[model samples]
Target: MAKETYQSLQAQIRKLQEKAETVRLKQRQPIVASILRSMQEYSITLDELKAAQAKGVSGRKRSVGTAKPAAKAPARQVAPKYRHPETGETWTGRGKPPRWLVAAEGAGATRDQFLIAQ
Candidate 1:
């Protein structure tokens, strides 16, 4: 009888633990959502957070107060392959067409007309 009761109590504890975890997750959702919203509002990036953590580990004081802005990545510049003769507007012909190119195309202009002289 004691062994049966112990087994029953163990089963109850398992059921209670499952219920507690579900409740904990339900409670945590709002907190987690608020944290995400706050991070978005402040424009906090993951790299900034990691940098701050690294600074903390290294005993840096300045970075602890404010995260240092990451160095600006070099802008990728592709030489323009197409140019408008009149306006001199240039494009690399890579991504979406610029407004001028779109307008010219809409007006029955072929892309070959805009090709820069090599």
Candidate 2:
């Protein structure tokens, strides 16, 4: 029954973190190798995949860097679900708040105050 000192606990935590990171990298190695193999087999480039991913996420038609569009379009377009009252700013309530919404919150307005009237 030994009591753990702060230094001992900290060292254990660092050791566990390093072990976890090593395990994570080991888990990721097969995926990375598969991606590399696929790129080589299909004659696809990483830049092309990145461009396609960006285009699909933003729902924008990017011309300069993208390859030919896939047979399907993005899943669907998301309509904005929230709007600022005074500034008439809109947000889809998906990822992060827009600057105007953040400012409004800073000014003591609650998030529900910006709900788009349905």
Candidate 3:
């Protein structure tokens, strides 16, 4: 049998990666659905999820002679700064503006118009 060419080996690797991803997704779909259902049933907030994760990490005993740094504290959530009058949608005035705000701006509405009253 002839030795595999560089291109042929690369093709085989790509095929294997795709196959592995397919298997992974198949295995994870049920797990993801179960997690989502549980989260919705419990009305679990992201903050609670992060708190649980942090609790899990801190509860684990550190190995002898290990010197890993402590985990950073979870970020505080900011209150919304803007709200749509009609839809009652809100934004925290952080990252990129939401689509509704941008489209309203294009339609001649000023950003300040959506500012939530203090």
Candidate 4:
């Protein structure tokens, strides 16, 4: 009888140990995941710093023509109208222009000229 009790107690202890280990693992999972995410963010930041340093070392040189493009003035507070001369399509400048507009302006379209009067 004593031997049987001892064996049963040992089995219970083993099950308890397993349960404790599982609980500990569950508690640690979030901390491990957060650490991995932080590491990835740090690596990204480091890569960006390296890129900025490289750009700094290479002196600014315009790939295009010698004439430096004129600096763009800040967007007007009030919405302006915009019209495409070629397409005759009109749009109210309620918000910032899309990437296509900037690319078009870079390609030599007079953006300000297209701006609709308030």
Candidate 5:
């Protein structure tokens, strides 16, 4: 009887350990995702700041010919692929632009224009 009780206790301990590990993993996943999102946001902001600085420096160059007003930087365009805004479903059909592209077109942008032009 004592041996049986010891075996049962061991099994319960093992099960508890497994449950604890699962709970720990569940708790960690959101933290990992949040960290990744923050990193991405920081990276994007850094890139934008760099681009703005470069543009400012370029604008200060002296020109000799007929001075043209600084041309607006082109928008950043992505591939002609379409992805759903909510589900991120990428469209693989023949020449079907992404949903974002469609929305931009609807907003009076030319077809194939990117959300951000450089």
Candidate 6:
């Protein structure tokens, strides 16, 4: 009859979530097995399944393992295009120029003078 504390309520929620997951898996196991059985009986291929999904035949599309969304390729590092002669600061020619480069330009130094030699 006593009111539950915040910690007790949180613990209950965690326990319920675990129980729900177990129940969900248990419930899905039969359905997944039946689907597999049907696929085997009908000789259905993964490609066919993907095609159906692409056509929006039914339900949301799913990708398993190798067919899942591809991880994007890593971005290549850009080489610095300009470097300060005295301080040795570098810039990749992207975005705004650094304070030193701006100051140097303001002081009558040209960008061509700061270009790093190939």
Top model number, TM-score: 6
Q: Per-residue error at 13 for model 4, in Å? A: 0.4
- Which of the two candidates, 4 or 6, achieves a greater TM-score against the reference? 6
lDDT against true structure, model 5: 0.66
lDDT leader:
6
* Sort order, TM-score high to low: 6, 2, 3, 1, 5, 4
Candidate 1 C-alpha lDDT tens digits along 1-118: 3556888889999999999999999999999999789889999877887887777753654445577858999999899999998989999999999999999999999999999888
How well is each residue in 80-112 modelled by candidate 3, as lDDT tens digits?
999999999999999999999999999999999
The lDDT of each candidate is: 0.88, 0.87, 0.91, 0.73, 0.66, 0.92
Report how far residue 104 has shifted in candidate 2, in Å: 58
Residue ranges of candidate 3 with Cα displaced over 4 Å: 1-64
Q: Which ten residues in a row have the lowest lDDT in candidate 5?
A: 109-118
**lDDT for 64 (candidate 6):** 71
Model 5 off-target regions past 4 Å?
A: 1-4, 44-118
Candidate 4 on 3-116: residue-level lDDT in tens? 568888899999999999999999999998886688697764656656766687436644466887679999766443787666666656656776556778899977787776
Writing each residue's lDDT as its tens digit, candidate 2 over 1-118 gives 8999999999999999999999999999999999899999999987898888876854776666767777876678789999877767788999988999888799998989788778
Instruction: Please identify model 4 stretches exceeding 4 Å from their true place.
Output: 1-4, 44-118
Q: Note the clash tally of each candidate.
A: 0, 0, 0, 1, 8, 0
TM-score of each: 0.41, 0.44, 0.44, 0.33, 0.33, 0.48
Cα RMSDs of all predictions?
Answer: 17.5, 18.5, 21.2, 18.3, 23.5, 12.9
Candidate 6 residue 10 C-alpha distance from true site, Å: 1.0
Question: What lDDT score is found at residue 76 in candidate 2?
Answer: 85
RMSD of 1: 17.5
lDDT of 4 at 14: 100
Candidate 2 contains a number of clashing pairs equal to: 0
In TM-score terms, candidate 4 sits at: 0.33
lDDT of 4 at 31: 100
